[model samples]
Target: ILRETETDVLVSYLPVGAEEATKWYVEQALTAGCAFVNCIPVFIGREPYWRKRFAQAGLPIIGDDIKSQVGATIVHRMLARLFQERGVRLERTSQLNVGGNMDFYNMLERERLESKKISKTNAVTSMLDHELDPSDIHVGPSDYVPWLSDRKFCHIRMEGRTFGDVPLNLELKLEVWDSPNSAGVVIDAIRCCKLAMDRGLSGALIAPSAYFMKAPPVQYKDDKAHRMVEKFIADLMRMDPDTARKVLNNEITAEQAVQIFERLDPETARGVIKAGIFNVEGLTPIRGAAKVAREFGVDYGKFTEEENTYLRGLMFLFYAWTRQNTPNWFRYITRNPGGFLAKFLAPWFAVVLWNNTIDEELEQSLPPWKRDQLHLITGYKDEDGKDIIIYFRGAPFVDALE
Candidate 1:
């Protein structure tokens, strides 16, 4: 069917009872050159062997389990985060789910529920900062009710202690249509897989998987996962085929690709600068000067007389006397200098030494004749009309007198 339809993506909604069949289905999907979206609790996306096989085949795969739009797992995870953020120590939690769907009926075989339990448990536990004992958190399908039809009910409770050892507890009851709860999430995941295929992207997509799946290839905080997915979608929309290829090949970042595209439009380039995207400090002077010249169409060499004079004075203040300084030193000062005068003198001259014993030792080490010459050159005269050396280290007078 995949070969005949030329399917771009394969959505796996198989039940846990068909666990052994998933391997054959995955192999078939890979052989058919279809991107795989694992919507079940099986561990294809999380397993290293399957991930590497899909990556080697150059096909994108997303998921280990689908997440509902507003399901019991998400509510429990959010409440856990709230408790942690409010300085409450979460001691124990549990979620009891009852549904009438085939999913719930299939889960009646407890032997098939180990993965489901682990997946849902980790979905909530990952939001916590502290370790939770395995016995403390219970999350799994509790019962099956034939009369409820498609309706599913979830009861979640969290037990914790607040400051001053005050006990705090929360309980929530969620009623949702079991199948439809995850239908929207599965659709979004399929679309993400299709987008990755269109962009020639291979391997597990971290952002979409983290945002849409219960047990993804990698887990991230919900807010961070949302932002990553947003950026991923925005990048796909902004990048052309070649740019997308470059990004997937690790040649450039999404921001760099955006900049490359923005540079083509002079107005956008100006807007980017105005928005302070590239107006950050610590940029190379030459690069900053060139950007200004190129964007505004100004000739840097043809400055006005006042501007030229100011520039000359600035250069003199920055680099007037450095005979022994390395080229790298000048490059470093050009980007990050303590003071303008520090560029011309030794790098250590920028700092004021506060050790009187070191100052005295330095003074005693200087030859009397050189000290006299240093004082004479610097024009230093005490009340006795004698040359008095303050500190000879890192001083311009030392080189001048020498």
Candidate 2:
């Protein structure tokens, strides 16, 4: 509606899990000739088709998701990095996230949760070098507690080796204000998108996305991502000399330039930089196809092999990284069948696996016909000290339970 009244840019602050609606809005923005800044977990900004569309139309766009300034993901990622750098043999890890928001409410549906899980899981998993089985690592939003409002709590646990055979563990709990936690970062993202418009940059902004999002088109270390945002901000200042000078002289607010640029046409926006009408700011000139895409308004470059390699490498690393840290015996059982069978043959393995100390307790209770009819039960001690019985649907014998 605003675009019909001559709005030039559309900055969407959609919540998570609104994948289809977010795409619909992006299409609406394109039809309106308004540039898009997608601040959500939907895949549009990172996907090739939409990126190509925006680039072709010469419309600026930034992001698939916004990262909180000092949120749990970064904190956990930093700790994981510390463990890896300090040579800890990280065996297993999990993050249980709880939040109260419409976003959190929406996520309870489960069906719309795939990308959210992927984004959060990959954020932590990308940092590791070793492979981990998918089962060993548990990283997902665990629950929604309504009383918390926008407050979210995250519990992160890691288990690994210290030096010799010494065991080490890490546990951290983070409580934060969710929507407000991300607002400041979105401010920077808006600036970055506007600057990208002015400079004519497009498709897969490596630095800005890495710094300000949980899932970027590519992954980089936190420090590198920070450096990239700083560089982008500096470049934006240089692209507008009059605004730069005004801000330097304290004659105009930086917010004023932001508002003005938000209204400029894509061509006029690009002209401001090409005419050298603005002072060149930023730590380095924007390089890579992101710059080309912005300038030409079309991402001619295809996704590279390096990205695929990184994705596979990160997934492999995560699968190997967290396996040993979990308690399930299935992971080990599949790996060493010979040793496992030997252990199972010994009486010790049976006792240890089943916790059956009494010899009589190990005896079969059901006859063949009764066993086949599912008339099988397990015995245990209740508080009353009498034999406690639990029935099973399938005829699982004592030996089979082992």
Give the whole-model CA lDDT for all candidates, comma-separated: 0.68, 0.60
TM-score list, all predictions: 0.66, 0.59
lDDT of 2 at 310: 24
What lDDT score goes with residue 236 in model 1? 77
lDDT tens readout by residue for model 1, 177-270: 9888889988988988888888778888889999999899888888889999988987776555444654666545566656444333544434
For model 1, give the RMSD to the true fold: 15.9
Report backbone clashes per prediction: 0, 22
lDDT of 2 by residue, 1-402 (tens): 966588766777776687778888988888887767677778777788987888777666777677788888888789888988999978899999899888788778888778877887788888888866788688877888999999999899999898896999989999999988988988877777767666555554557778888778778889888887786686456446445444333434444445444434545556544543333332111111112223332111232433222222212212221232232233333332232222232232111122213223332422112334422222233345433222222222222222
Model 1 misplaced stretches (Cα beyond 4 Å):
266-402
- Top candidate on lDDT is 1
Q: Which stretches of candidate 2 lie over 4 Å from their true place?
A: 240-402
